[model samples]
Target: MTYRRAAIPALIGGLLLAALLWWAGSSADALRLPGSVGTLGPDAVAELQRWVAPWAYDPPSFLDAGVQGHGYVLLGDDGRDRYNGIYTAGLQIRYGAVFAAFVLGALLLIRRLPPVRGRTTAAFLALWAWGAAAGTLAAAVSAPWFIAAAGHGSHRFLPQLASVTAAGRQLPVAVSLVAAGATVLVARIAAEGASTPPRTEVPARAARLAATAGTAVIALSVVVLSYQPVAAALQAYSPDGGLLAEPGDLLRQWLLLGAWDAPAAGAVVDWLLHRASDVLLLAVVWWALSRLPGLLTRVTLPAMAAGAVGATVLGLLASQLLRIAVVQTGPQQGLLYSSAAIGNGIPAALTCGLLAGVVATAVLRLSLRGAPEPAA
Candidate 1:
């Protein structure tokens, strides 16, 4: 039951999960071009060249045309269809593996720790570490697929080719870290024994209110910033010679600027505004459950599930409102166009909020469940 003993199972679970993710990710698509230019007609090759021309980083040339032609041969209509199927399947496998691994790892680790005060923190830390470790391993093992998919020709087409590749490669790693964090939260809550006494309700309520207020402020700010004129003004005054020339361009520029200046204090504020609701949803779920012990204890799973749904609904509503606001205040045509980006609309916000709420509920339950009864 010691940390040392518990770590063995954790390590094994992490390794197994990592291996599964790597296998799924790598095998999701054929890594190489499917065919060669020799198999295609000259006219077909010329059309393919035109299709990929915009993506080319260098001056248009016969060599570039050939390379692009080869790429299309590999990823023609059939290849595209196959890639989609494989990618979807891979995603399911990866998510399932992450979810199952976290639940199993959390239960295993929870049992090993002494049932004492502060064990929740310990459990959270353990789960977080395990998730991160597993994710890192999966990312490392899955590198071959991404590298092969990028191919030599991709470099010639994209100016920030290396950065793009790195970002692609890091997708699994980010997913793993997030999965781990959520698992820890859920496990922490579940580990709290059924009969354990509840803490004072006042503080939980207060915290929830404060979190709600904070979230509201940030969401409003984001909506305001998304207002086309406001966004244009911000971009114009920004240090990096604002790039918000066109209507839909503000959102893209904001995102790029945020990424480029992430280390800066201002960027941190932007990040918070972008993810305010998700960040605050933890407090909302925790307090809501605290106020309703029956929901927290008897229907724990259902409550968490509901929280996820609620988060999604709230996110969508917020997004819709923002869209309406943008349209009312800005140009009509590009009003809803930028909603596809993260922090700009419903999908990303809903996803982030749902995950956070579910995880927070789980961890809060474990934390509340106190020490296990001693055996005779």
Candidate 2:
């Protein structure tokens, strides 16, 4: 009966989720400039700004409209068509990969701890709210981090925060609505079965370790997912920030593409270092969580909360140190980067990790309540 109730919402939610993810990917592509603007002339910046204006905002000025018209003329019909096709295709691929991951992760997590009560609906909604807040907060912090990492933008914090806040306010309604609906649908589906399945038990120590690792994965995913929007905000506000404009995957190319005979080798090393930072952070979080007890039970909530906060601080410090070691940079630059990271790291981690801890606990509590105790 519960399963029957969930089907309709789940189907609708799935469709909405697809649309939202695509829109997010499209926004990323649209905000990005055609090429590096480090050496762009004033006319080129004007043209590009006019071209990107429609996506950036609405109710374009007459002058902006005129500039866009000129841009189209410059590109010509054939070039314009080709660019449009590439943009559309890039968005499709970006969203497809992310949406695939979301679906797979959602299903795996749901199956592991299937929702077994109607109250799961409320739980899902709460999780969604927490996630939204977490993303917004990450943007607030990361906006400044973007500038600091670049080392050339305004060092002022208030403007950076305001830029991110404005971007958050401008998010499309469709995206928010669809995201909320999807969360409810996930909740409904997870709670469909009322029968208490047999609870699986592992060695106490092992279960704690697994739970710790899982929590870290959840927290880290939040951090990575927020990067897209934050990056977009940077592009919007500081289009001419040179290397700052093209971080992420482009960082490797800029650093090692020259002066190295084997570009591929450089890429491999770059990838390793990038991943190593993430792994290092993950390990730190795991260690932090391990210090807490009752990892698999309701008692785990406080532990998870505290551990997550600690993990964030430790992780940030560790990553900064690693960056200094790898880059072999002077103390001044290193301190500047570290300060930027800390500025964002504390609040972002606190908000994301705490809320994640709460949500994870809620899911676990529900799952445990539904499942039967293990037999001797």
Q: Quantify all predictions' global Cα lDDT against the true fold.
A: 0.37, 0.41
lDDT, candidate 2, at 276 = 60
The residue ranges of model 2 lying beyond 4 angstroms of the native Cα positions read: 1-11, 20-73, 117-181, 185-194, 202-204, 210-376
Model 2 local distance difference test score: 0.41
User: Compared with the true structure, what per-residue lDDT tens digits does model 1 show for residues 56-157?
Assistant: 222223223332223444445554544444334434444445445444544454444322354444444444433533332232233333333333323332
Tens-digit per-residue lDDT, 1-376, candidate 2: 2334444444444445556544453454443455534555445444434333322322223222322222333444554444444434433443343344334323322333234443344334322322333333333434443333222244334444444332332222225345545656555554545554333443455445445654554444434443455434433453345444433322221111011122255488765565566566656656644433232222446544544544544554466457556643565443333333222233444555565556544544554565555331
Give the Å shift of residue 117 in candidate 1.
16
Where does the lowest 10-residue lDDT sum fall in candidate 1? 253-262
